[model samples]
Target: MAILDYANPTRFLRLTQIVLPWLTAACLAAFAVGLYMTFFVSPEDYQQGQTVKIMYIHVPAAWLCMMTYSIMAISSLGTLVWKHPLADVSAKAAAPIGAAFTLIALITGSLWGRPMWGTYWEWDARMTSVLVLLIMYLGLIALWRTMEDPIRAGKAAAVLTLVGAINLPIIKFSVEWWNTLHQPASVMRMDGPTIDTSMLVPLFVMAGAATLLFFVLHLQAMRNEILRRRVRAMRLKAAAGSRAARMAPPSSPLSSPMSGTPGAAE
Candidate 1:
């Protein structure tokens, strides 16, 4: 299948080179339009006023925070179950990006919360779980770096990623399961979004833009990872070759003048 072809690093690199330009352009265009809508078109919330606009950035970052990890989790499965060649590269590259998004979500949430909740932070379920998600992201990044061998690192990180996945559901349903300062599903609901269309349109537009941004970033990161791995492999091969050359036994030469004894007459 076409997807399987990408397991080959060469093919993947080619695809990335072709796709990245388009993705970048789309991402930039979406962000431009989304920002304009967020600041100008969407009216201020009656309840939160201008502070509510923070939702545009906060919500999208949070979505990416979780979405990036979800991608990693799937990649982990690819590494362990399917043994796809680039699976580890994909997972490794995504960790830092996910962490960045998580950090953004946390900071923005705190800023938004200070005005609404009268506190910068609380130990409530939703907040705490998100904090846990951030910590998990940090831990995974550390795990990858701590291991020298990519193959081994990937396998180990894959297990940890899968284990950490338990938190995803917890973060999502934390509000419903327990008391929390954070509000429950206003936009993502079974009955459809509760927010007014005016605001919803902007939110969805921003979400689309953010999603595009993630792909642009994700693909770029994957390319870098692939190149890094190639460099590493080359170095290893060079080191091995040098070591072999050093250890090889020296060659011996037969005397051309063995002759002296047999041909005495000169």
Candidate 2:
């Protein structure tokens, strides 16, 4: 019932308009503080030295890369099960942002890896699984584009998203499961975060900033999607009206003869 209430596109747009400015401001302010903390406050790693700074960006990007997918998967469920009007829009809108975050993670990880691992890339399980996740995001985007009908596309994408979710855990535990070059989880381990408070503070701030930015982007994207659908509907209606007008029989000129109605046939 609550979901249905928000299904109205107009209502959603109205809400977004009211909240978007606030979200934008928050995103900007948080990012500023996060960046400042990341570069200025965080110290160099004992072993990795300056390369450790990349973690500030790489870690948060990695987190959002997974997080965005999780959001889409949940939205997909709403699309497939409840048929919530905005569900597909949310999922669709998130794909590009997820893809971008995934790319940033991959790039920054490679940059950090070169000095530590002596190479930019290795066919490590963690890296490989993350690559697969990126591929899944791209594939979902392609699927959405290839289908003309939004409803059909949404259902198809939802099914694919649910099926591909198996990769999430693989990405998470790949370091632990295999003899990989990738480092094991330090922050999210059974023993709690091994990272010092000095580093953890900036890491948390960056992570929060990234999450806020994702929401801002996602909401704006959904708003655009709703407007696009509205334009499409209007075009279809206009086209249909034109076709109907063309198909209608033309009125006969003789029906209103200038002389007299009684002798119109003559």
Candidate 3:
């Protein structure tokens, strides 16, 4: 009931504003702890040494990139199907943030790879699919911006998002699904996580921190987008009013500015 109730714009605005400050604080605190754990507490990998530290940032970012796209896709579907206003806002808000996360993951993954794999990148199935995911994000953003009709844009973006979602599974299973330079799964295996406890804690903590930060960033971005919409609406309304005023029939005491007074007429 509460979830559906917040579909109202005023309700959402109030609710998000109330929770936003606290969420922001929590994100900052968690990030600090996660950073400390990643840098100081986690043991170095036997093979990669200190460089393995990059995984703390890289893996979580990669996960978020996919997770955010899923969220955006679902939100877009909801906006298109139910015409949920907040759904559109959520999808729009998630795009650039997701794109940024994808870019970070790619850059950090490359940095880690250069040291470990002796190259910056490989044309593996996973790498290519992830690149597709980033382009999908960009495409969604572009489509939304290109259309003036909100509903039309939302529907088009939603369709693109759903189509792109096919890439996510490929990204997830690419190592096993194909012979690739990328490694197979470590934490999520049938036998359970293979990672040692010492390294696992920081990785988990960093993942948690990244998730919190995504939520915080999403909320802030949604607020900004809502404001942008309001500004646009107001501008359009003002312009329409001005146009109407200009087109209105004149109702004046004098017909023209240069109209003569009684003495000048005489």
Candidate 4:
């Protein structure tokens, strides 16, 4: 399978090399369109005024926060179950990026909330759950650093990541499960989007751009990780060789100076 062939790091790197330029172009184009629409075309909320524009980016970042973690969780599964060589690389690369998105969501949410909620923060179910997600991201990153061996680190982090996944559903349903300042889903529903079409269009555009950006970043990070592992292996092999040379006993040749006629053995 084309996808399975990429299980090899070399193949995966080749795929990234070929696709990254196009992905970057598309991502930039989407962002340009999304931003223009957000600033010029989209209407402001009657109640929140221009503050509503924050939703364009806030919503996308929030989605990415969850989506990135989902990727990590799936990659973790790949590591523990499938033994895919690139799985840990994927998972490791996604963690920091996910954390960045989560942080963006929190900051933007706070800025948006101050105008709408009359405060920057509330220890509400939705907000708290997102905070927990950020903490988990940081923890997984630390776990990776704590272990020197990639395989062992990947397995350990994989288990922890899966454990943290329980929080995701809680984060999603928190507003519904409990009374919270965070609003319920507006666009993502079976009944269809509640927002007007004008606003929804740009929102979707922004979300798509954000998703593309994530993949671009993810792929680049994976390539770097694969190369990093290769370098580590080479360094270890060199160290082993040096140690072997040091441990080897020194030997004298049979035709040494002491055995010659000038200094023959007595």
Best by lDDT: 4
The C-alpha RMSD of each candidate to the native structure, in angstroms, is 10.0, 8.7, 8.9, 9.1
Per-residue alpha-carbon lDDT of candidate 2 for residues 110-181, written as tens digits (9 for 90 to 100) = 887788877898666656667878999999999999999877898999999988886667655864466334
For residues 52-132, could you state the per-residue lDDT of candidate 4 as single tens digits?
Answer: 799999989989999999899999999999988889999999999999999999999888878777789866555677888
Better lDDT candidate (1, 4): 4
TM-score of each: 0.84, 0.84, 0.83, 0.84
| Candidate 2 wrong stretches, greater than 4 Å | 1-7, 170-192, 249-266
lDDT of each: 0.82, 0.82, 0.78, 0.84
lDDT per residue, candidate 3, 156-186, as tens digits?
A: 8887877777666755576446633344442
Best first by lDDT, ranked: 4, 1, 2, 3
lDDT of 4: 0.84
Query: Which should have the higher lDDT, number 3 or number 4?
Result: 4
Error of 3 at 132 (Å): 1.3
